[model samples]
Target chain A: MTKVSIHVTLKEGVLDPQGKAIENSLNTLGYDGVHDVRVGKLIEMFIDHDDVEAQVKVMCDKLLANPVIENFTYEIEEGVAQ
Target chain B: MTKVSIHVTLKEGVLDPQGKAIENSLNTLGYDGVHDVRVGKLIEMFIDHDDVEAQVKVMCDKLLANPVIENFTYEIEEGVAQ
Candidate 1:
Protein backbone atom coordinates (compact mmCIF):
# COMPACT_ATOMS: atom_id res chain seq x y z
CA MET A 1 0.00 0.00 0.00
CA THR A 2 1.06 3.56 -0.67
CA LYS A 3 0.50 6.34 1.83
CA VAL A 4 -0.69 9.70 0.63
CA SER A 5 -0.14 12.87 2.60
CA ILE A 6 -1.83 16.21 1.97
CA HIS A 7 -1.25 19.69 3.32
CA VAL A 8 -3.78 22.48 3.15
CA THR A 9 -3.40 26.09 4.14
CA LEU A 10 -5.08 29.42 3.54
CA LYS A 11 -3.69 31.84 1.03
CA GLU A 12 -1.76 34.83 2.18
CA GLY A 13 -3.93 37.73 3.34
CA VAL A 14 -6.63 35.34 4.36
CA LEU A 15 -7.79 35.66 7.97
CA ASP A 16 -7.07 32.65 10.18
CA PRO A 17 -8.81 32.81 13.53
CA GLN A 18 -7.36 29.47 14.61
CA GLY A 19 -3.88 30.59 13.80
CA LYS A 20 -4.40 33.83 15.63
CA ALA A 21 -5.41 32.01 18.78
CA ILE A 22 -2.35 29.81 18.56
CA GLU A 23 -0.13 32.79 17.90
CA ASN A 24 -1.47 34.61 20.90
CA SER A 25 -0.84 31.56 23.06
CA LEU A 26 2.67 31.23 21.68
CA ASN A 27 3.37 34.88 22.43
CA THR A 28 2.16 34.37 25.96
CA LEU A 29 4.56 31.44 26.11
CA GLY A 30 7.39 33.94 25.39
CA TYR A 31 8.29 32.77 21.89
CA ASP A 32 9.06 35.88 19.90
CA GLY A 33 9.75 36.51 16.19
CA VAL A 34 6.67 34.55 15.26
CA HIS A 35 5.13 36.62 12.49
CA ASP A 36 2.17 35.89 10.29
CA VAL A 37 1.02 32.76 12.01
CA ARG A 38 -1.22 31.17 9.43
CA VAL A 39 -2.61 27.72 10.21
CA GLY A 40 -2.86 24.78 7.84
CA LYS A 41 -4.29 21.23 7.82
CA LEU A 42 -2.64 17.91 7.11
CA ILE A 43 -4.14 14.58 6.07
CA GLU A 44 -2.71 11.14 5.45
CA MET A 45 -4.27 8.00 4.02
CA PHE A 46 -3.31 4.56 2.87
CA ILE A 47 -4.62 3.25 -0.41
CA ASP A 48 -4.21 0.01 -2.26
CA HIS A 49 -6.22 1.54 -5.07
CA ASP A 50 -4.67 2.95 -8.21
CA ASP A 51 -3.94 6.55 -9.26
CA VAL A 52 -3.07 7.71 -5.81
CA GLU A 53 -2.61 11.32 -6.80
CA ALA A 54 -5.86 11.71 -8.68
CA GLN A 55 -7.92 9.96 -6.04
CA VAL A 56 -6.41 11.97 -3.23
CA LYS A 57 -7.03 15.22 -5.13
CA VAL A 58 -10.66 14.38 -5.57
CA MET A 59 -10.95 13.52 -1.89
CA CYS A 60 -9.44 16.85 -0.95
CA ASP A 61 -11.87 18.83 -3.09
CA LYS A 62 -14.97 16.88 -2.18
CA LEU A 63 -14.77 16.66 1.62
CA LEU A 64 -11.27 17.11 2.92
CA ALA A 65 -10.99 20.84 2.46
CA ASN A 66 -12.68 24.14 1.68
CA PRO A 67 -11.26 25.44 -1.56
CA VAL A 68 -12.34 29.06 -1.15
CA ILE A 69 -9.99 29.57 1.76
CA GLU A 70 -7.70 26.58 1.56
CA ASN A 71 -5.46 24.65 -0.83
CA PHE A 72 -3.90 21.20 -0.54
CA THR A 73 -1.15 18.99 -1.98
CA TYR A 74 -0.44 15.29 -1.71
CA GLU A 75 2.41 12.82 -2.16
CA ILE A 76 2.45 9.07 -2.39
CA GLU A 77 5.08 7.02 -0.68
CA GLU A 78 5.18 3.57 -2.20
CA GLY A 79 5.97 0.52 -0.11
CA VAL A 80 5.32 2.54 3.02
CA ALA A 81 2.73 0.15 4.30
CA GLN A 82 3.71 -1.55 7.54
CA MET B 1 8.84 33.95 -4.27
CA THR B 2 8.00 30.30 -4.29
CA LYS B 3 5.54 28.92 -1.77
CA VAL B 4 6.10 25.69 0.08
CA SER B 5 3.21 23.61 1.37
CA ILE B 6 3.91 21.04 4.05
CA HIS B 7 1.57 18.24 5.12
CA VAL B 8 2.11 16.38 8.38
CA THR B 9 0.24 13.46 9.88
CA LEU B 10 0.62 10.42 12.09
CA LYS B 11 1.30 7.02 10.59
CA GLU B 12 -1.41 4.40 10.49
CA GLY B 13 -2.36 2.68 13.77
CA VAL B 14 -0.95 5.66 15.60
CA LEU B 15 -3.44 7.18 17.99
CA ASP B 16 -4.38 10.76 17.21
CA PRO B 17 -5.85 12.70 20.10
CA GLN B 18 -6.66 15.78 18.05
CA GLY B 19 -8.23 13.70 15.34
CA LYS B 20 -10.32 11.84 17.89
CA ALA B 21 -11.58 15.15 19.27
CA ILE B 22 -12.47 16.25 15.77
CA GLU B 23 -14.09 12.91 15.08
CA ASN B 24 -16.31 13.27 18.13
CA SER B 25 -17.21 16.72 16.90
CA LEU B 26 -17.93 15.39 13.43
CA ASN B 27 -20.15 12.69 14.84
CA THR B 28 -22.10 15.48 16.47
CA LEU B 29 -22.22 17.21 13.07
CA GLY B 30 -23.87 14.09 11.64
CA TYR B 31 -21.16 13.30 9.15
CA ASP B 32 -21.40 9.58 8.57
CA GLY B 33 -19.05 7.04 7.04
CA VAL B 34 -16.17 8.66 8.86
CA HIS B 35 -14.31 5.70 10.20
CA ASP B 36 -10.78 6.69 11.10
CA VAL B 37 -10.10 10.29 11.88
CA ARG B 38 -6.45 11.21 12.02
CA VAL B 39 -5.59 14.87 12.32
CA GLY B 40 -2.75 16.35 10.38
CA LYS B 41 -1.11 19.77 10.04
CA LEU B 42 -0.47 21.94 7.01
CA ILE B 43 2.01 24.81 6.64
CA GLU B 44 2.54 27.18 3.75
CA MET B 45 5.38 29.69 3.45
CA PHE B 46 7.13 31.74 0.79
CA ILE B 47 10.85 31.62 0.42
CA ASP B 48 12.87 33.73 -1.99
CA HIS B 49 16.08 32.19 -0.88
CA ASP B 50 17.97 29.57 -2.84
CA ASP B 51 17.73 25.87 -2.00
CA VAL B 52 14.08 26.22 -1.31
CA GLU B 53 13.43 22.50 -0.91
CA ALA B 54 16.29 22.00 1.52
CA GLN B 55 15.37 25.04 3.55
CA VAL B 56 11.74 24.02 3.81
CA LYS B 57 12.66 20.50 4.85
CA VAL B 58 14.97 21.88 7.51
CA MET B 59 12.22 24.16 8.73
CA CYS B 60 9.85 21.22 8.97
CA ASP B 61 12.30 19.18 11.02
CA LYS B 62 13.59 21.99 13.21
CA LEU B 63 10.50 23.91 14.26
CA LEU B 64 7.50 23.44 11.99
CA ALA B 65 6.67 19.89 13.12
CA ASN B 66 7.42 17.16 15.62
CA PRO B 67 8.96 14.32 13.66
CA VAL B 68 8.47 11.81 16.44
CA ILE B 69 4.74 11.93 16.01
CA GLU B 70 4.31 13.57 12.63
CA ASN B 71 5.63 13.09 9.12
CA PHE B 72 5.46 15.93 6.62
CA THR B 73 5.69 16.38 2.85
CA TYR B 74 6.20 19.69 1.06
CA GLU B 75 5.66 20.98 -2.45
CA ILE B 76 7.34 24.02 -3.95
CA GLU B 77 5.16 26.06 -6.27
CA GLU B 78 7.35 28.38 -8.29
CA GLY B 79 6.07 31.86 -9.10
CA VAL B 80 3.31 31.56 -6.56
CA ALA B 81 3.85 35.11 -5.39
CA GLN B 82 1.04 37.51 -6.00
Candidate 2:
Protein backbone atom coordinates (compact mmCIF):
# COMPACT_ATOMS: atom_id res chain seq x y z
CA MET A 1 0.00 0.00 0.00
CA THR A 2 1.26 3.43 -0.96
CA LYS A 3 0.89 6.14 1.66
CA VAL A 4 0.16 9.51 0.08
CA SER A 5 1.28 12.77 1.73
CA ILE A 6 -0.20 16.18 0.93
CA HIS A 7 0.48 19.73 2.12
CA VAL A 8 -1.76 22.78 1.63
CA THR A 9 -0.65 26.36 2.21
CA LEU A 10 -1.74 29.89 1.40
CA LYS A 11 -0.25 31.88 -1.47
CA GLU A 12 2.26 34.55 -0.64
CA GLY A 13 0.80 37.97 0.22
CA VAL A 14 -2.37 36.25 1.31
CA LEU A 15 -3.42 37.44 4.72
CA ASP A 16 -3.39 34.50 7.16
CA PRO A 17 -5.14 35.23 10.39
CA GLN A 18 -5.01 31.60 11.46
CA GLY A 19 -1.26 31.54 11.04
CA LYS A 20 -0.96 34.62 13.18
CA ALA A 21 -2.79 32.95 16.03
CA ILE A 22 -0.62 29.85 15.77
CA GLU A 23 2.52 31.95 15.81
CA ASN A 24 1.35 33.72 18.91
CA SER A 25 0.55 30.43 20.57
CA LEU A 26 3.94 29.05 19.63
CA ASN A 27 5.64 32.00 21.19
CA THR A 28 3.67 31.53 24.38
CA LEU A 29 4.62 27.86 24.29
CA GLY A 30 8.29 28.85 24.14
CA TYR A 31 9.29 27.62 20.68
CA ASP A 32 12.47 29.32 19.51
CA GLY A 33 13.83 30.44 16.11
CA VAL A 34 10.27 30.54 14.92
CA HIS A 35 10.19 34.27 14.39
CA ASP A 36 7.86 33.68 11.47
CA VAL A 37 5.34 30.89 11.66
CA ARG A 38 3.00 30.25 8.74
CA VAL A 39 0.71 27.42 9.63
CA GLY A 40 -0.47 25.09 6.85
CA LYS A 41 -2.46 21.87 6.46
CA LEU A 42 -1.00 18.40 6.07
CA ILE A 43 -2.93 15.31 4.87
CA GLU A 44 -1.98 11.67 4.60
CA MET A 45 -4.04 8.76 3.25
CA PHE A 46 -3.31 5.11 2.66
CA ILE A 47 -4.89 3.56 -0.44
CA ASP A 48 -5.84 -0.07 -0.62
CA HIS A 49 -8.60 0.66 -3.10
CA ASP A 50 -7.56 1.83 -6.56
CA ASP A 51 -4.41 3.36 -8.05
CA VAL A 52 -2.94 5.10 -5.04
CA GLU A 53 -1.20 7.89 -6.88
CA ALA A 54 -4.04 8.78 -9.25
CA GLN A 55 -6.73 8.64 -6.60
CA VAL A 56 -4.63 10.76 -4.28
CA LYS A 57 -4.31 13.43 -6.96
CA VAL A 58 -8.01 13.26 -7.73
CA MET A 59 -8.91 13.63 -4.08
CA CYS A 60 -6.68 16.65 -3.92
CA ASP A 61 -8.42 18.29 -6.87
CA LYS A 62 -11.88 17.48 -5.62
CA LEU A 63 -12.73 17.34 -1.89
CA LEU A 64 -9.29 17.22 -0.38
CA ALA A 65 -8.47 20.85 -1.08
CA ASN A 66 -9.57 24.28 -2.16
CA PRO A 67 -7.58 25.75 -5.05
CA VAL A 68 -8.28 29.36 -4.16
CA ILE A 69 -6.22 30.75 -1.26
CA GLU A 70 -4.45 27.40 -0.88
CA ASN A 71 -2.20 24.97 -2.84
CA PHE A 72 -1.21 21.30 -2.41
CA THR A 73 1.25 18.53 -3.39
CA TYR A 74 2.10 14.94 -2.35
CA GLU A 75 4.35 11.90 -2.73
CA ILE A 76 4.30 8.14 -2.10
CA GLU A 77 7.06 6.74 0.04
CA GLU A 78 8.43 3.19 -0.27
CA GLY A 79 8.77 2.95 3.48
CA VAL A 80 8.64 6.23 5.38
CA ALA A 81 10.58 9.42 5.73
CA GLN A 82 11.57 10.27 9.30
CA MET B 1 7.26 34.29 -12.16
CA THR B 2 5.74 30.95 -11.31
CA LYS B 3 3.74 30.19 -8.22
CA VAL B 4 4.01 26.81 -6.47
CA SER B 5 1.11 25.53 -4.47
CA ILE B 6 1.69 22.80 -1.87
CA HIS B 7 -0.64 20.90 0.42
CA VAL B 8 0.33 18.96 3.55
CA THR B 9 -1.98 16.56 5.31
CA LEU B 10 -1.87 14.00 8.09
CA LYS B 11 -1.46 10.32 7.30
CA GLU B 12 -4.59 8.34 8.08
CA GLY B 13 -4.77 6.69 11.52
CA VAL B 14 -1.87 8.78 12.71
CA LEU B 15 -3.88 10.15 15.61
CA ASP B 16 -3.95 13.82 14.74
CA PRO B 17 -4.18 15.91 17.87
CA GLN B 18 -4.35 19.16 15.93
CA GLY B 19 -7.05 17.85 13.61
CA LYS B 20 -9.02 16.65 16.58
CA ALA B 21 -8.91 20.11 18.07
CA ILE B 22 -10.04 21.74 14.84
CA GLU B 23 -12.82 19.25 14.29
CA ASN B 24 -14.06 19.84 17.79
CA SER B 25 -13.91 23.58 17.25
CA LEU B 26 -15.78 23.27 13.96
CA ASN B 27 -18.51 21.29 15.60
CA THR B 28 -18.76 23.80 18.40
CA LEU B 29 -18.90 26.56 15.80
CA GLY B 30 -22.16 25.06 14.45
CA TYR B 31 -21.02 23.52 11.19
CA ASP B 32 -23.47 20.73 10.37
CA GLY B 33 -23.06 17.32 8.68
CA VAL B 34 -19.39 17.75 9.40
CA HIS B 35 -19.16 14.62 11.53
CA ASP B 36 -15.53 14.55 10.60
CA VAL B 37 -13.12 17.41 10.24
CA ARG B 38 -9.42 16.86 9.71
CA VAL B 39 -7.24 19.92 9.56
CA GLY B 40 -3.93 20.00 7.70
CA LYS B 41 -1.21 22.39 6.46
CA LEU B 42 -1.06 24.41 3.23
CA ILE B 43 1.96 26.29 1.83
CA GLU B 44 2.16 28.40 -1.34
CA MET B 45 5.33 30.02 -2.64
CA PHE B 46 6.11 32.21 -5.66
CA ILE B 47 9.40 31.66 -7.47
CA ASP B 48 11.19 34.12 -9.69
CA HIS B 49 14.53 32.52 -8.84
CA ASP B 50 14.76 29.31 -10.87
CA ASP B 51 12.57 26.54 -12.24
CA VAL B 52 9.44 26.95 -10.18
CA GLU B 53 8.36 23.32 -10.39
CA ALA B 54 11.79 21.90 -9.61
CA GLN B 55 12.36 24.13 -6.59
CA VAL B 56 8.89 23.30 -5.35
CA LYS B 57 9.56 19.56 -5.21
CA VAL B 58 12.90 20.20 -3.59
CA MET B 59 11.42 22.50 -0.98
CA CYS B 60 8.88 19.80 -0.23
CA ASP B 61 11.68 17.32 0.29
CA LYS B 62 13.83 19.63 2.37
CA LEU B 63 12.56 22.20 4.90
CA LEU B 64 9.04 22.68 3.51
CA ALA B 65 7.75 19.28 4.77
CA ASN B 66 8.20 16.57 7.32
CA PRO B 67 7.50 13.65 4.93
CA VAL B 68 6.25 11.60 7.90
CA ILE B 69 2.71 11.43 9.13
CA GLU B 70 2.18 13.97 6.32
CA ASN B 71 1.67 14.06 2.52
CA PHE B 72 1.63 16.88 -0.07
CA THR B 73 0.75 17.83 -3.72
CA TYR B 74 0.39 20.97 -5.92
CA GLU B 75 -0.46 22.60 -9.26
CA ILE B 76 0.45 25.69 -11.34
CA GLU B 77 -2.34 28.05 -12.33
CA GLU B 78 -1.87 30.51 -15.16
CA GLY B 79 -3.91 32.97 -13.16
CA VAL B 80 -5.65 32.11 -9.90
CA ALA B 81 -8.36 29.84 -8.54
CA GLN B 82 -10.57 32.66 -7.32
Candidate 3:
Protein backbone atom coordinates (compact mmCIF):
# COMPACT_ATOMS: atom_id res chain seq x y z
CA MET A 1 0.00 0.00 0.00
CA THR A 2 0.99 3.62 -0.50
CA LYS A 3 0.30 6.26 2.08
CA VAL A 4 -0.40 9.75 0.81
CA SER A 5 -0.75 12.91 2.84
CA ILE A 6 -1.97 16.13 1.28
CA HIS A 7 -1.83 19.61 2.70
CA VAL A 8 -4.28 22.04 1.15
CA THR A 9 -3.79 25.67 2.04
CA LEU A 10 -5.35 28.91 0.96
CA LYS A 11 -3.44 30.94 -1.57
CA GLU A 12 -1.78 34.19 -0.58
CA GLY A 13 -4.00 37.31 -0.45
CA VAL A 14 -7.03 35.16 0.25
CA LEU A 15 -9.12 35.90 3.33
CA ASP A 16 -9.34 33.23 6.06
CA PRO A 17 -11.94 34.08 8.65
CA GLN A 18 -11.53 30.79 10.51
CA GLY A 19 -7.85 31.41 11.02
CA LYS A 20 -8.55 34.93 12.21
CA ALA A 21 -11.00 33.63 14.76
CA ILE A 22 -8.41 31.19 16.13
CA GLU A 23 -5.85 33.97 16.42
CA ASN A 24 -8.30 36.11 18.36
CA SER A 25 -9.13 33.27 20.67
CA LEU A 26 -5.46 32.56 21.29
CA ASN A 27 -4.77 36.19 22.13
CA THR A 28 -7.73 36.28 24.45
CA LEU A 29 -6.40 33.19 26.16
CA GLY A 30 -3.12 35.11 26.75
CA TYR A 31 -1.02 33.57 23.98
CA ASP A 32 -0.28 37.03 22.69
CA GLY A 33 2.71 36.08 20.53
CA VAL A 34 0.51 34.17 18.11
CA HIS A 35 0.00 36.01 14.84
CA ASP A 36 -0.94 35.48 11.23
CA VAL A 37 -2.62 32.17 11.99
CA ARG A 38 -3.78 30.34 8.89
CA VAL A 39 -5.81 27.17 8.82
CA GLY A 40 -5.82 24.50 6.09
CA LYS A 41 -6.85 20.92 5.42
CA LEU A 42 -4.82 17.75 5.73
CA ILE A 43 -6.05 14.68 3.90
CA GLU A 44 -4.45 11.29 4.47
CA MET A 45 -5.25 8.17 2.52
CA PHE A 46 -4.05 4.75 1.47
CA ILE A 47 -3.84 3.65 -2.13
CA ASP A 48 -3.02 0.25 -3.56
CA HIS A 49 -1.69 1.36 -6.88
CA ASP A 50 1.32 2.61 -8.81
CA ASP A 51 1.79 6.15 -10.16
CA VAL A 52 0.60 7.34 -6.79
CA GLU A 53 1.82 10.88 -7.19
CA ALA A 54 0.02 11.54 -10.43
CA GLN A 55 -3.13 9.89 -9.13
CA VAL A 56 -3.03 11.99 -5.96
CA LYS A 57 -2.55 15.17 -7.96
CA VAL A 58 -5.64 14.39 -9.98
CA MET A 59 -7.61 13.68 -6.81
CA CYS A 60 -6.54 16.98 -5.29
CA ASP A 61 -7.42 18.89 -8.41
CA LYS A 62 -10.75 17.20 -8.88
CA LEU A 63 -12.21 17.12 -5.38
CA LEU A 64 -9.76 17.69 -2.55
CA ALA A 65 -8.83 21.31 -3.23
CA ASN A 66 -10.01 24.40 -5.05
CA PRO A 67 -7.18 25.30 -7.43
CA VAL A 68 -8.39 28.89 -7.81
CA ILE A 69 -8.13 29.74 -4.13
CA GLU A 70 -6.09 26.94 -2.57
CA ASN A 71 -2.82 25.15 -3.21
CA PHE A 72 -2.07 21.54 -2.36
CA THR A 73 1.12 19.58 -1.74
CA TYR A 74 1.35 15.86 -1.13
CA GLU A 75 3.84 13.31 0.17
CA ILE A 76 3.70 9.68 -0.88
CA GLU A 77 5.26 6.75 0.92
CA GLU A 78 5.38 3.46 -0.91
CA GLY A 79 5.66 -0.19 0.20
CA VAL A 80 3.75 0.22 3.40
CA ALA A 81 2.15 -2.96 4.68
CA GLN A 82 -1.60 -3.14 4.39
CA MET B 1 9.85 34.95 14.41
CA THR B 2 9.02 31.29 14.79
CA LYS B 3 6.93 29.35 12.29
CA VAL B 4 4.80 26.59 13.75
CA SER B 5 2.54 24.11 12.02
CA ILE B 6 0.05 22.03 13.93
CA HIS B 7 -1.73 18.99 12.52
CA VAL B 8 -4.89 18.00 14.32
CA THR B 9 -6.39 14.65 13.43
CA LEU B 10 -9.24 12.59 14.73
CA LYS B 11 -8.19 9.86 17.10
CA GLU B 12 -8.53 6.22 16.17
CA GLY B 13 -12.09 4.88 16.57
CA VAL B 14 -13.53 8.37 16.26
CA LEU B 15 -16.31 8.72 13.72
CA ASP B 16 -15.22 10.79 10.72
CA PRO B 17 -18.16 11.48 8.48
CA GLN B 18 -16.19 13.98 6.47
CA GLY B 19 -13.55 11.43 5.66
CA LYS B 20 -16.13 8.83 4.74
CA ALA B 21 -17.81 11.30 2.43
CA ILE B 22 -14.53 12.12 0.74
CA GLU B 23 -13.72 8.45 0.31
CA ASN B 24 -17.09 7.83 -1.25
CA SER B 25 -16.62 10.77 -3.57
CA LEU B 26 -13.21 9.53 -4.65
CA ASN B 27 -14.59 6.05 -5.38
CA THR B 28 -17.40 7.55 -7.39
CA LEU B 29 -14.89 9.66 -9.29
CA GLY B 30 -13.14 6.45 -10.45
CA TYR B 31 -10.31 6.41 -7.97
CA ASP B 32 -11.00 2.87 -6.90
CA GLY B 33 -7.65 2.13 -5.33
CA VAL B 34 -8.05 4.91 -2.78
CA HIS B 35 -9.15 3.89 0.69
CA ASP B 36 -9.11 4.96 4.32
CA VAL B 37 -9.47 8.64 3.59
CA ARG B 38 -8.99 10.73 6.73
CA VAL B 39 -9.45 14.50 6.98
CA GLY B 40 -7.75 16.72 9.46
CA LYS B 41 -6.73 20.30 10.13
CA LEU B 42 -3.45 22.06 9.51
CA ILE B 43 -2.78 25.30 11.32
CA GLU B 44 0.20 27.47 10.46
CA MET B 45 1.19 30.47 12.51
CA PHE B 46 4.00 32.85 13.33
CA ILE B 47 4.98 33.62 16.90
CA ASP B 48 7.49 36.12 18.21
CA HIS B 49 8.45 34.29 21.30
CA ASP B 50 11.29 32.24 22.72
CA ASP B 51 9.45 29.15 23.95
CA VAL B 52 7.48 28.44 20.81
CA GLU B 53 7.00 24.72 21.35
CA ALA B 54 5.60 25.09 24.82
CA GLN B 55 3.40 27.99 23.80
CA VAL B 56 2.00 26.03 20.88
CA LYS B 57 1.34 23.01 23.07
CA VAL B 58 -0.70 25.15 25.38
CA MET B 59 -2.56 26.66 22.48
CA CYS B 60 -3.39 23.20 21.15
CA ASP B 61 -4.60 21.99 24.50
CA LYS B 62 -6.55 25.12 25.20
CA LEU B 63 -8.34 26.02 21.99
CA LEU B 64 -6.84 24.56 18.82
CA ALA B 65 -7.90 20.94 19.38
CA ASN B 66 -10.26 18.89 21.40
CA PRO B 67 -8.22 16.48 23.48
CA VAL B 68 -11.17 14.19 23.88
CA ILE B 69 -11.48 13.14 20.26
CA GLU B 70 -8.49 14.57 18.44
CA ASN B 71 -4.72 14.37 18.64
CA PHE B 72 -2.30 17.06 17.56
CA THR B 73 1.34 17.27 16.54
CA TYR B 74 3.42 20.31 15.66
CA GLU B 75 6.62 21.33 13.95
CA ILE B 76 8.48 24.54 14.77
CA GLU B 77 11.01 26.45 12.71
CA GLU B 78 12.92 29.15 14.54
CA GLY B 79 14.29 32.49 13.38
CA VAL B 80 11.94 32.84 10.43
CA ALA B 81 11.85 36.37 9.02
CA GLN B 82 8.71 38.31 9.81
By lDDT, who's the top model here?
Answer: 3
Greater-lDDT candidate between 1 and 3: 3
Off by over 4 Å in 2: A1-82, B29-32, B78-82
lDDT of 3 by residue, A1-82 (tens): 8989999999998999999999999999888999999999999999977788889989999999999999999988777776
- Poorest lDDT segment (10 consecutive residues) of candidate 3 chain A: A73-82
What is the DockQ ranking, best to worst? 3, 1, 2
Q: Model 2 over residues B1-82: C-alpha lDDT tens digits?
A: 5444566666666777765664454445543223333566665444453355765566566555578876767776453333
Q: Evaluate model 3 with DockQ and give the value.
A: 0.93
**TM-score ranking, best first:** 3, 1, 2
Model 3 docking tier (incorrect/acceptable/medium/high): high
Off by over 4 Å in 1: B1-14, B17-37, B43-82
Q: Please, what are the lDDT tens digits per residue for candidate 2 over residues A13-78?
A: 777887566445544654322333455666544445345566556666765567887677777765
lDDT by residue (tens digit), candidate 1, B1-82: 6766666668666798876775565456544323355777765555565677876676677766787776777777887743
**Cα miss at A23, model 2 (Å)?**
15
The best candidate by DockQ is 3
- The lDDT values for all models are 0.65, 0.56, 0.93
Q: What is the interface RMSD of candidate 1, in Å?
A: 5.0
Please provide, for model 1 over A1-82, each residue's C-alpha lDDT reduced to its tens digit, 9 standing for 90 to 100.
6766666778666898876775565456543333345778765555555566666666677767788877776777786743
Off by over 4 Å in 3: none
